[model samples]
Target: MTDPTGVTITERHEQDGIVMEILEWSRLGGMTDPAGLPLLALMRTAELPVRQLRLTLTDAAVVLEAGALQAWHGRIEVENTIPAGRLLRRMVGSALSGERLFRPRYSGTGVVLTEPLLQCLLPVGLQDETVIVDQGLFLACSGGIEVGAAVQRTGSALLFGGEGLVQTRLSGTGFAVLQSPVPDSELIKVTLKKGETMAVDGPFAVLRSGSVRFSVGKSAKTWFGTAVSGEGLMQILEGPGDVWLSPLQPVYDGFAALARTLGPDATEAAESGRRR
Candidate 1:
């Protein structure tokens, strides 16, 4: 799966008239300093793959997240297909669901590429089914799919579930690409039977099928019981469908926060305080 441009196709997915290739760079360039060489070697040893998506389309159309298009080739036409009548409604839905108001649609035959991202790209297929995903997870989808907003079923879920009042809902028969915080290997998929329940303490549930119901409830019968159990409110999902959970997302978030705190600006401030 190696390409002439030093990019390797780590994964490939083909479904519903689209071919997607997950490209990863074997080695990064542009570093000239000897000191940076050690850091680069360390990054290679750590296996931190920088990935991107390459899509091949033939007489088909796809909708991409705003600003996701990096480049394209062949005969392709791009347009914002927002109808004037639904402009106001789309705007409000975008605000509540945290999705961009305008998603560019690319139609015709072409090879499309998206900007390189550190996050993992997950491709999901649907056959007359629907799935609800957390906001900001959507990257691209086939034109046959319908993208809309889904509101929280209850007030407690909206307030305590950690996901906002609305989430992104995708329906119809096609494929969708989602930007996941963690790699697919780390994701835990749970299929629940009818009336089965799953509870989580954090916003670790990234996605759930449309048949599932999301809510929030106390971990124990009372506040005192919850405190004693060391668990408080939990996000609850009642289902007869699939749910994808990323239990390691919180660890990644903690590391990112620590990196920000120890960034160059903080280092410079510390040096100034020491000098003073």
Candidate 2:
């Protein structure tokens, strides 16, 4: 469906869950000003992942993390979801979540298309539920959902286990979309009963937000045992809900492996180089 213009959005590969938004080549006016010819040629074969979400005016408001918006049709009012008083906290939370500090809020009826991304998009429905996401995994969520930081049980836990000192936490009744490098097929799901616990080796956890308590603790009974066992500090998930684990996160895999290969000092320098 074209959005009242030459831009046509359609689900060309519905079975693969891919929606294609094609901007008619004939409508490319100044688009040919620079390297337009080659760009137009490349656009023909490019199978992009465009997400289309329909909005209802009086229903739930759609909230997109900063810059997630690509195009939209209908009357949608834009605003910042962050409260004026909680700006500082939000900033800190953003730093920990490895996401942009400001998220844009859109409300009213309309259809919005998100820009194509390399990662797969996951649509999650929550009814008074909670989910903890990996750092940088969040894309957008419903305005009724609460966004904040999910902190580790302790500082030591934070350093050895998680992506960082904090991760993104979503709660309340609504739907959410997360970007994950791992496909849904490979993401293994394990449900834990009350008083049950599981230990993970690395940052294999994708999400364990449903009635799950995540922490970092000794791999064994004693410090000597842990050190000799080469287990170090491990992520211990205690639960009564679900846990999703991915084999890898391509975004963080290289860097994390490099950090492990090098010592602590070299890892810091490597991180600094990455920042630069």
Candidate 3:
């Protein structure tokens, strides 16, 4: 939908290397509620080309993944939350892997902006809850919560498979926001009862935490058995918790499918490089 101005504020534009959309509406008109509360909500501006996700905060705090603030207005307080001597080790692990250990805490009475890639925001509700997130995926969460330590797995297959070594975990009683690759409509939430087990052949898992046991192991006991199983390395999740997965498979799936679509020329070139 167009902006309320009848002019062109909601339109998307590319400046320098960044793509941006200027939003305008009644909410953006400095309108406040009866108690003087800001109308905070996530607004979807356009469906394609430039899909937008807007979040407004009313007198709250958000822990942003460091350096993610795009723009903001009104009463905003920004501060760097440095870890003390007790938590230095855990914080250092995240910093080594391209993620900021000590992220900036955003709290105030105004609105904050984010995004250069136009990704959708996934708000995760936490009640002493914990979410193990891929590095750099941490967006913003309520001030009541805390960003916990990093998670690591030393499996040889997991590293070479591109899952990486470090992931951030947020835990507390509030809502944590994450930058979602798939939109909320496309995210599939699967609830597994206690003692139940499920395995995914791909890294489709977005978030898996809370009483769930997660590991990367062989698809089968034997090499020949794995071949018959038609699965190589697998992400195993044992529950009593929720798992969010994407239908698009994983990151590699996109490249593989695109290569197939571009036909034999692309496939042959990739195969030739692999041989070399």
Clashes of each: 0, 0, 0
Q: List lDDT for all candidates, in order.
A: 0.85, 0.68, 0.63
Q: lDDT per residue, candidate 3, 1-276, as tens digits? A: 223442234444332222234343322334356332211221112222233333455666767677777877767788886657746775567566655656788666665666544455566777777777766667777677788655555565346334566667888877776777777888888998998888877766778775777777678988778768878777778898888888675664677688778875664565456457
**Model 3 score (lDDT):** 0.63
RMSD in Å for model 3: 12.2
Task: List clashing residue pairs in candidate 3.
Answer: none
Pick the TM-score winner. Answer: 1
Error of 1 at 218 (Å): 0.3
lDDT of 1: 0.85
- TM-scores, all candidates, are 0.88, 0.69, 0.69
Model 3 per-residue lDDT at 19: 27
lDDT of 1 at 188: 99
Candidate 3: stretches off by over 4 Å: 1-58, 154-162, 227-230, 250-276
Worst 10 residues of 2 by lDDT: 11-20
